[model samples]
Target chain A: MVSTYVTSSLILRILLVYLMVSRIAFAHDANEASAYTVQEIAEGNFVHEGNFPPQSLENRGDIANIGFIVGEKCVAVIDVGSSLHVGSMLKAAIQRVTRLPICAVIITHVHPDHLLGLNAFTKDDSITVYGHHRLPKQIRTRSRFYLESLEQYLGAGNTADHAIDPSLVTPVNGLLSIDLGNRVIELKSWDYAHTDHDLSVTDIKTGTFWAGDIVFSEHVPILDSNIRQYNAVLEELQKLDVQHYVVGHGSLDRPWDVLISEQRRYFRVLLREVRAAIVNDISLMDAVNTVGWTERDRWHNFDMYHRRNVTTSYTDLEWED
Target chain B: MNFVKRILTFIGASLLFCQLALATPFPEPDHSSIPEWIMIKQLMFGEREIRDGSDDILALYLNTKLDDSSTVPIMVNALMDQTEDKYIKTLYLVIDRNPIPTAGVFKFKPEAGRVKLETRLRFEKFSFIRAIVETNTGDLYMDQRWVQVAGGCSAPSGKNANDPSLGKMRFRMDDQIRLNEPNLVQFQIKHPNESTLASDLEPGYAARFIDKVAVEFNGKSIMSGDINFSLSDNPIFKFYFSPQAEGVLSVRAEDTHDTIFTDSVEIGTDKR
Candidate 1:
């Protein structure tokens, strides 16, 4: 009778220890699921700034700043990141903040980093997608290439769930106004600013301008449209009256006008050097490396895209009088 | 312990020898003190002596670090004036490492103002591109740029494979052809110029490209290009042509698919 009692006691102790350990493991996993930390830039405005990493399997394409605006009735999401995984995380962040139904997803442009995470909102029938008027055409023309590149970076298994659906997109031809319950958001589409199709959003209640790629703070300014038109847009942006701004890339540490001035200086350098090369009868091959090299230390990723920028500017300006 | 030490010493010695072998300069004739230039000279000119050009007479301009291998922009300008006596007669573009080393052989008349040509080409590997110019007296002058980019011949054409404009040609020039002064003429042809090494290709198809291009004026050949996949999809060329008399300028292009595209422009006299 004594031996049986001792054996039973030992079995009970082991079972109890196993159950306690499992509970701790489960709690640890729950903490990891809500790892994304969001900062409130303004009243009812929440933003999640991602790391400045290239699209890869490690980061899983969460390399852009994405945010949400919560009003009395609904929510508006600005730029949903680069993958479905990131979109899900952003959704979790929204759920943590408010239970308000997401009313709209505003895509700033057609870049994969800004536009690919759109499918995460497709499940909700009430949510509407908005983009510039030229967004649909760009999506159709460039999606396949983007998808192929994504697969190369992230394996096919990760990319299988991500895609661009043009049919669900509502093209924003001009100024469109949306009411997120009590707060009013104004969306303006510009002509060949950062891209052929670029839209900027402004919250009337908070005076915060979500200036997509039109303005970059720490990152180097990338030019995809006409340089002359891009410079013209920058001059016009100086006249806008806004309290705070959220750029597409980099930190919101600098003043808006300061960022614009710095970018303008860089572009003017490109223009002056490119025009000189053409007059001197230099080839496009040599101009790319030699032009705009003086500004190498001022911006991040200067070596990667600045040469391509020179190429784009040179070809376009060659046609100019 | 003694045997193990000897084995370790032997392994280290072998690795050092291998590194030394790899560090040896590429075995070719010395042309410009740059190894790639020496190799290129051997590949293109063989035992022939290539004369370094005077800065005032000839200069070649191209991107040294190529961004796009398939369509690298290149320009060759004769620094010397084009007079009735001395002018550039022929221009040869050679990409040493490309499967087809000779990219183009262009013959120009004195009417071609100033002897300047601008075009885009494909590069298969990181190699030297030499632009050799032959004057009327058979003097050869060479200018070369070392490019550090590859994979021009095998890049995919980001277009639909089956398009109606395949093998179609389009020609652009001033409405009126001027005499004496050089006028810019551009010709564009639609073809995949598909490279075998390109990824995202449909299974079972090898590669196809425009293999030959011939430009003639009134039955006389002005320039001819023996091209390869190094030409980008929808190959386009913009060059200066001086018209002495009103004649028909015809272009003929043949692809690896045996498809021929021909187009002609009538050089009308400019009254102004």
Candidate 2:
């Protein structure tokens, strides 16, 4: 009779423990629903591919791909997505895969699509944020404008509630290397290319190049820097012997050189036509609509950005010899 | 006589009703009639020959739908031949609904190649932007484009207005002045050209901008402009002038801050 009583208590305790453990598991599973589906592109490399859409309430600015690399000791996040919610999902994704501590969050540029979710990782003191040397100035100057745009597109409630504080950023002036156990990642800050403050990351083990916006896959290239300088950077990028490249936009399935050549063609057309327009004394008004228009069919979202690109390139190239 | 008077009254009433029923979405200018335009024309030209631009001698180009109110691009091309004897004497950019109707006044000499001028502007509201060209013979030809964009004069100045180079002036011209030919001269002044609407959002800040510009060739006024917030930040003006004699082409710009910036480009003779 005593043994029977102990057995009943034992079963009850086992059931209680099982209920508590499942509840905890269920909580994490719920978060995983919102979590990104990360694919292992290489050994210990995971990438979440996002849809190609403009920043709107429907998409909630989930229009840029973000991923992370796992080293033997820790992990490095390439980008944190576009909002605090997306960032939280990314963190959940990391937890689902491994329990390793996040060592660094590397921001490739100052674009909101890549940097707005930075606050998600800021709470963790172990994670150090890295950006280009010019990033702090850009963030200071442009953060307010970006926030205003974010509120307009994503609504006030959906915004990440993050403010750009330069003090928290560790600036990468030139080439710097970070060791994640057995893996070594090289970080390089580029000159006026995609933006004045653009950083690229390369994994020495897998030979994977994380080229922020420097290499766009399908999205129309935006020109915020000197077009001449951008072209020179593209030439320099072509010479690099990279095994695989992760671009800021478009499909990563295409070969790295193919994407580079395609981008180069767009830049070349813009330069040739804009210079010709300047020499022919065509006014900016006409040039904005007509210059480099032949490639309209080749690029996606060509109508949204091509004219502005022409305007930027024209204004910049007019001063060129 | 009584019958004729009754018919005239009926016609005038019908026309007024028709105008009110047009239902145009844009806000029409306060003074849109021929007589109203002539009143401003008389105020500006003072008994000059003003005629409708039926000949299409002057063309004004602007985007019908503009996204950026602060920096609007505008181009004016004068098709009339410009020679020493006769050329386009002046081009007046008139935005009917702006706080200042005269956006800019550009003077051109024969040496200005093709009589083409391009620059950026600011529009206060939805209205017609007229490019009135006056030839050397005192004949005025007008062409206009109805722009639907607004909020240019009163839009926020994205940059902080407290910068130190608020009224610095810069000039770009040919190193060698082509005498008796049209040489292009461009000048830019660094100022926020703040608008009252922009000031409304910032506490303890008042609107300020370059209010006047005087361009002189050899101390003779080529053109002078009275500007307001309708000009973009760091207001730029590009025009053509024939260097009559090698001297100085000086520009003096004054802002609401009571600061005057003066710059001059020496017109040296071109090497033969």
Candidate 3:
């Protein structure tokens, strides 16, 4: 009788311990799911402001501003974060706001930070991905390097399940409007400006413009494409009468015109100085060191990216007739 | 006591699992010694000793903190001027960790007056950029700068292959030319210099790049280089050429696709 009692009590103890441990694990996941907070900038339009620092393991690759819009029946997700973890958090954030199914995912560009989190939402068969028409080609060429970089940032295990499928993206050539029941979001793809391909979103109901990386506010503007073309695109963007706007990085407190002008001025200076350097018989190596020092204090992270801008400008404009 | 021990072991196991789930920290930049260099050195120079060139022979200049991996401007300057008796006959540009370790092998004529090479390169990873000089007496000296850049070889070439001005060349020089003195001239070719490692490149399509670059003054060779796609797109070179008299500075470049681009600028006596 004593042996039977002891055996029964031991089994009960083991069962209780297992239940407790599993429950704790479940609770931990729940906490992580709700960790990302979103602010409704406009009605039905939510934005999660990301960190200012570059992607790091500590940040879990949440370096870009990402959010989604809820309509009457479904939701449209804008640029997803950099990793699966970030995407899952955004998904959970959406669930916390509404139970609507995500019908569309709009990618702003082919950059890794905005494109890698796509797989997290892709698991659901209902979501149709949208990006620039040129995005698919860029993805095909750059995805391998981006994945390797992700592994470097988030480690092998954290990134093992991450994969970028270019075929999943629906190419947006010029102007495409997506209807989410009562709300409609217009996606416009621009010519080579910030990148070879860049897409911007506009919420028709709210009149809020998601400028993507085309209009950087506080962060130093990165010139990956033609400077003259980029400046011309900015001139066109300035004409849009936006009631509300979200930049790719930095707070959106400044006036839209001021933001556009500041970015335009940076590129203008780069174009002028680089051209002068080429004309004055200055070597490309020497020009990078001295070309863009005047705008150093005007923008953040200028030291890290300005020399590169000079290099690009010198190489491109050197070919000008 | 047995139950307590079991619970402890379970907690310990959970902690271990959690540790595994977390991200691994990034590796520190290690510049102590590169294993790739050991093997590359053996193949390029069989049992040949290399002396440090930073002190007197030549110096390599490059920014250690690279922003763009695809286009990095670098310069190599010879500390001593080129002389007929003891001049740097050949210069080797080597990137230790690239797919092709030898980026270029440039031959310099002593008549050039001085040896200076300025060009842009693509770095595949964090590796050393070495400027190796071989004197006429067969002595080798090397200067290296460690550069931190990645994915340059696979980075998509921004140049459109179907550009209308493809294979065009341009030459720039000072307004005035001096007789019997080293004058700087820069020449650039408009080519993609496409790398095979670029992922989007179609399989079975060979990557096209400049293989031979020859510069001459009045039909006499001054600088000739055997190069590869390690040179950035639209390869530009700046070097010194001594002008004994008025002559045409001509450049003929041949690519892997069997296309030849040639351009020349006349050095006028009016400037002299």
Candidate 4:
């Protein structure tokens, strides 16, 4: 009778330990699920709005908007976040919403903020990655530097097991349409704009447009490519009939046309002043400091990126005949 | 068998330790005593004394708060006018942290009334840009500026290699030519000045950059330089030249790929 009593107590202890372990695991998962919260902006479109600050350890490199669109049968992820941790959080957010398998991932550009989290979603065997035709070449050249930077920003431990495989990306030359069961999304490749290789996505059913880095809202628009071409692309984007839209950065509270026009006005002032500087034989060194001071108080992070925009415009406009 | 197993375990543990050591982020070493400068100074000067030139001989001008790493505008001006007895014969522009530290070695003639070089350069990282001028008597004087810029080496040179206007040249100067005085002239060449460290370059392809530049008036050298990809794309050079008479001011530039680009503007006494 004493032996039976001891066995019963032992079994109870084992069950208690199992329950504790399972509960801790469940709590950990719940924390992760809450970490990346998404809002259903439209009927089927979900977006996790990111902060406006630059990538830092505190932000975990989650400075760009990333989300997914669910269809009746499958889902398509617009962009993964800046790092694997952010991407995994996004994946958890998707799981919380629906159980549909992810069919495709559309990359916006070659910038580290948009491209680094790609490894997280590429793990699934059924997922196919899409990007501009020029993206693979850009990746081949830039991945090493981006990886080194990732190690610096997030510690080496967080950066471990992360690798960017450019070959996994299927090239989208001009316009390519993919079907997520009954719903179809169009991926468009653009000429040199924000970056040389920029891709934008549009959902046919919901009329939701993912502008990627092509259309930045509050945060200063970065110019990694030609300024004139960027302005031209902005004009082209103005014509699109976007019902619901997601910008690459900042809040989408304002109408899409207002965002594009603000960005255009910034570039216009930059272009005019820089061209005048060049025409007046003002040195590039002086142009950077004095060219774009008029629009100083208008934009966020203007102090950080406005000079760079001036530099880009000065160099490009100097070649003008 | 037991001994062998212990040895294998020790090897694996050592490997892990080595990786951990590599993974740990350490504070950046003090840049005041830059180790690269030590090596570069030894390689180039070889025990020659370099005096401070900021106060008397030359001045290096660059903004400490650099906006663009790939295209930073810089100017180096000689404090004294060029004369037969005391003239700067050679000017060396060096970025301490660039892959090719010596951006250019320019040779100047005493006929140029004043020496002022205004150009653009690419900085790989936050490092000192040194302008070391060698006088006709072989005296070395240096002026250095600390510039904070990064990632220029690995950033893609955005120019298209197959551009139709690859070797085109342009010249700009005052509408009226000044005679027997220091007249400023600017000339530029169209080349990518591709750096080997540019990340977007294809594998196994040699980086093509302008390696030689010669500026002359009436077949007499005014300013000539041995430059490299450390210069920014579409390299532009603005300097002062004194022409004794009406003559052709010409520029010839050669790239690493052995292609030469040449252009000239006739400086006449009357405004054209």
Candidate 5:
């Protein structure tokens, strides 16, 4: 009886050790509150196991981040990086992991830093790029001008044509998901808060949520047509139980609940004070004068942005009522 | 036996990985508890153009909201009392607002003309939009757009959002598309208007706000003002100026750290 018990116990220990080794291989370097991983890539789901080389025209510093995820069996590439170089580099990275075919590329949003690598994803079947309805429109409208600005900013190393036709566009509505073998990726859309159309992604395997532009990590949240709606959305993000949040511009974070919570509190406070200023008939000047303005110090050259935020918030408050 | 040990070890390893994957950047954020004084971080001064996408003149009217020690109506009275000017008409107070509650712009008709002056103001959250105009008769009309950003005074910079290096700051001037004499100029830049409640990515660190800006006309001071973080990045601003006065226009901005950015351009009177 003792030998039998020992034999079973030995087998259990071996199983435990094997699982431990696998887990150790994929450990995350950053400190997080929780952790998880993918089990397998299911069939029909696309896999981004190839590189979509960035166009020769993309400027450096213009590409923020790049990567792709799988849904069921097909794959979806997240970012193509700055230029043709980064895009190609990412494709190679994708090839290293999976052999599944890449079905489409989701721009996430319309910023050059995020979508300039469109050329890499275009394929014979005409790889579809998804974003908010306004996104493809924005890409077609501003590609040239933005290209000029990018060239001026990053110099010639990112030289290439910047025009992208809306023909390859696939606009996403409320929420969409990619089913990896044993994983699921959830993509959600928000108003023009960060930009004209911001799309976020979620990995169910690890519960790592990718917030393209909505959740900025250590970077600035670029503004667009609306700030009121933006603030409201930021407040709403708090309602999610996100574990890992990968912002469009910064590092990933665990316990996204905290990020959303803090952002919500901020907008609420801003609304109250601005409302008060209006009630007292503070001349836009006196209101500006009477109330002291602060915060945003460490941001390199934030003065220029401060003025814009004020205008956006004030307009939102006024129009809201 | 060895296989069993390996499986057990694998389970242990995976548990450890999970902990790191879900670690929160900042265990606790400073959502509340920020002092009122610490909220407002910067002061800014600039003129807002209140016009459709046309060259026609816009009349601006204004209201005020000073601390109880001094009411907006009282402040307006005091301002008029000091300016020795009477053309300033109308006053409205914004209310239910957490910060200051009174401030609005006065609208102007085609006849309200020839206006140029700088003034100081207050805000609750860093948000305040306005329209200003002057009539040929010295009648000043202004429109105030109240905002709901309560943390405006000290809203953290955008850099506090996620990636600071992704910082993209710019200074630009948009040329007048229509007429010359009363042309509208577009001024814009980008920066993270940080909120006071905003903590550094590592947590514990608080973001700062903006302070001052100097607008120069031909190397001379045209408009110098204070600012706050209530502003947004890549702030696009529009204002009306005496288009007839031809000179090299330069703008220099200074924030809390005393960081200075100077960009200049020549305003062409005949661009229209």
Candidate 6:
């Protein structure tokens, strides 16, 4: 009877310890997720962009994690990253999840925010940076400007990682393809939308298109593009079959119909305004002063962006055919 | 005959409507107030003070007034996103490119104030910019004024960055940091901070991005960092830190290939 009692108590003790430990671990995990409030937009889709915006000394947030998606063999990185440090962190993070080579880097557009980060990919033989043909040239010509921008944004003692070898530039134009063991990604360029060299990537299997700046989910679209070209591009994209997407600036989203409609409406209004200005023979300034922008109050940076859009539209309509 | 008349009327009406809409004039942004972030109260240029309380979070407040041309949301978001911490909060709000998009404020923690900086900004039309102070304890405070022009910061550096290389590093100082006070480090280095927004009148930027920097105090290592591509041209940074000993204050900088450059100053214990 003594032996039986001792054995029973020991078994009970082990069970009790297991339960207590499990509860503590589970609680810690819950706290962690809430602290960062990480919301994974797409499952099976890895993120490569380092913490939406890169690290800032004067930044207002406390969380920092590079975006990643794990693949079968070599993973696909959306934006490689800005500096060598970010690049190093990105590589380590990807390795943590998989042993795949960085198959290809898809630059959504020519903007520094999207493309400059590719310098991080060290294994040149295996990795390829896919962007519009105009991309490599832009990097070559706009390199200095990019450096200045770094100084303005990152401040001193922090730019150590911004060094990039311009000679290592890898440029591509037209359609590009990536075969990731089980998945196939097809990259297609948009004819003059956000930039002269805008490319959109579609994961054939998932039916999700990485829509660069062609679709900004949150803020107003900065106009590096003329209205006619932008409108035409939008119309062209609307005809394609896209179900899910990753926008350049805002959160990745589903339910594309509404977003597309709103973007289209904006362009339509702009075209109409410009068309009116031309007929009335209003000076460019007067025409800019005329858009009854009450609709602007509804959005955050509408006026700042709208004026640029209006200016571009007016100039395009006014200038060459 | 009635069907024919209906078709003709539709065609004529469409043409007339198009003409009327095209006949209107362009709209203009209102210029009324100053934008925020142009001032640093309590913290003067080259001034130092003890940070109150030892809590980790740094709270910074900014205010601004704006009119129609202000790209209010983008600039604000840019500022917020630039910080990356997300803990930075906006205590006040306003934008006047609309019915009343005039003023706003943002509050951030002490830890969030990585480096104090100054830059020319774009404040479409005209308006005041502002932000309030909120400690982790929940005290609220505010600051701001208006900017007169439309686009200033993004209007292009107007300097040709295509000139072969990021320019040579230039340094200036009064020979030493005033004793017991934070040292005034003035640095001007060649960098493009390329937005990739410019085109080459001449073919340039033939290499990868290169914006690397580092700073050390006395003989102790302080901090090293990577400058993002968003920094302005010929970058200028003025920072402060208290020193304990009088030693050679040296600055060493390098680019991607690890090509290093150095400059040093003799920090003496007493001033003449």
Best by lDDT: 4
Native contacts recovered by model 4: 0.47
* Residues A1-321, model 2: lDDT tens digits: 999999999898778766765775698668555555888877877888877756544355677888899999999999887777677778888988999899999999888889888899998899999999988766765566567656545433444467767778899999999998999999999988987778999998988899988988888888767788899999999999888778878898988888889999999999999999977767666777788889888888787677767766765565554
lDDT values for all models: 0.77, 0.77, 0.86, 0.87, 0.47, 0.51
Q: State residue A309's C-alpha deviation in candidate 2, in Å.
A: 1.5
DockQ of 1: 0.11
In model 4, what is chain B's TM-score?
Answer: 0.87
Pull out the clashing pairs in model 2. B111-B181, B111-B182, B112-B182
lDDT of 6 at A202: 79
TM-score of every candidate's chain A = 0.90, 0.88, 0.90, 0.90, 0.69, 0.76
Every model: iRMSD: 11.2, 20.1, 5.3, 9.1, 18.0, 21.8
State the weakest 10-residue window (summed lDDT) of model 4 chain A: A152-161
Candidate with better TM-score, 3 vs 4: 3
Tens digit of lDDT per residue, candidate 3, span A1-321?
A: 999999999899988877777777899788766667888888888998887647754466787888998999899999988888888888889988999899999999988778788888999999999999989888888888888887765543556567778888999998999999899889999998888899999999999999889998889998888888888999999999888888778877789999999998898889999999988878777788899799999988888788888887788898888
Question: Which wins on TM-score, candidate 3 or candidate 6?
Answer: 3
Output the TM-score of candidate 1. 0.63
Between candidates 2 and 3, which one is better according to TM-score?
3
Q: What is the DockQ score, from 0 to 1, of model 2?
A: 0.06
Candidate 1 lDDT over residue span B1-272, tens digit each: 34445655786676555445434433443436655556666776688766777477778877554566666888788888666698888788887778777777777776566777777777876677788988887778888877766656654444444778677776767677778677777787777777666634446765777888888888887667777766666776777777778888899999877878898977788632
- Which residue runs does candidate 2 get wrong by more than 4 Å? A1-35, A156-160, B1-60, B65-71, B76-117, B121-213, B225-235, B240-272
TM-score-based ranking: 3, 4, 2, 1, 6, 5
lDDT of 3 by residue, B1-272 (tens): 46556876987776555445443322434432678888888899889999988899999998655788999889999999988898999999999899998999999989989999999999998788889999999999999887878888889887787788888998877788888889888889999998988746666778888999999989999999999988999988989988898989889999998989999989975763
Model 3 clashing residue pairs (backbone): none
Best by DockQ: 3
Q: Which stretches in model 1 have alpha-carbon errors above 4 Å?
A: A1-33, A156-158, B1-71, B74-118, B121-220, B224-272
DockQ of each: 0.11, 0.06, 0.43, 0.29, 0.04, 0.05
TM-score of 3: 0.91
Kindly report which residue stretches of model 3 are placed more than 4 angstroms away from their true locations once superposed.
A1-31, A158-160, B1-33
Off by over 4 Å in 4: A1-32, A156-160, B1-32, B199-204
**Per-residue C-alpha lDDT of model 4 across residues A1-321, encoded as one tens digit per residue:** 999999999898778766766776699678756877899988889999987756754466788998999988899998888888888888888998999999999999988888788888887889999999999988887777778877756544556556788889999999999888888889999988998999999999989999999998888889989999999999999998989999999997789999999999988889999999998999998888899798888878888888888888888888898
The sequence of per-residue lDDT tens digits that candidate 6 reaches over residues A1-321 is 999999999888767766666776689656543333323456556553223342343221111222444456767776654555445555666666567677776666656666555567745767766677766655655555566656544433555356554445455567877787778788787667876778777777767777777876546666676667887888777787876666665445536766677777877877787887766655344556565364576444575566657755664564423
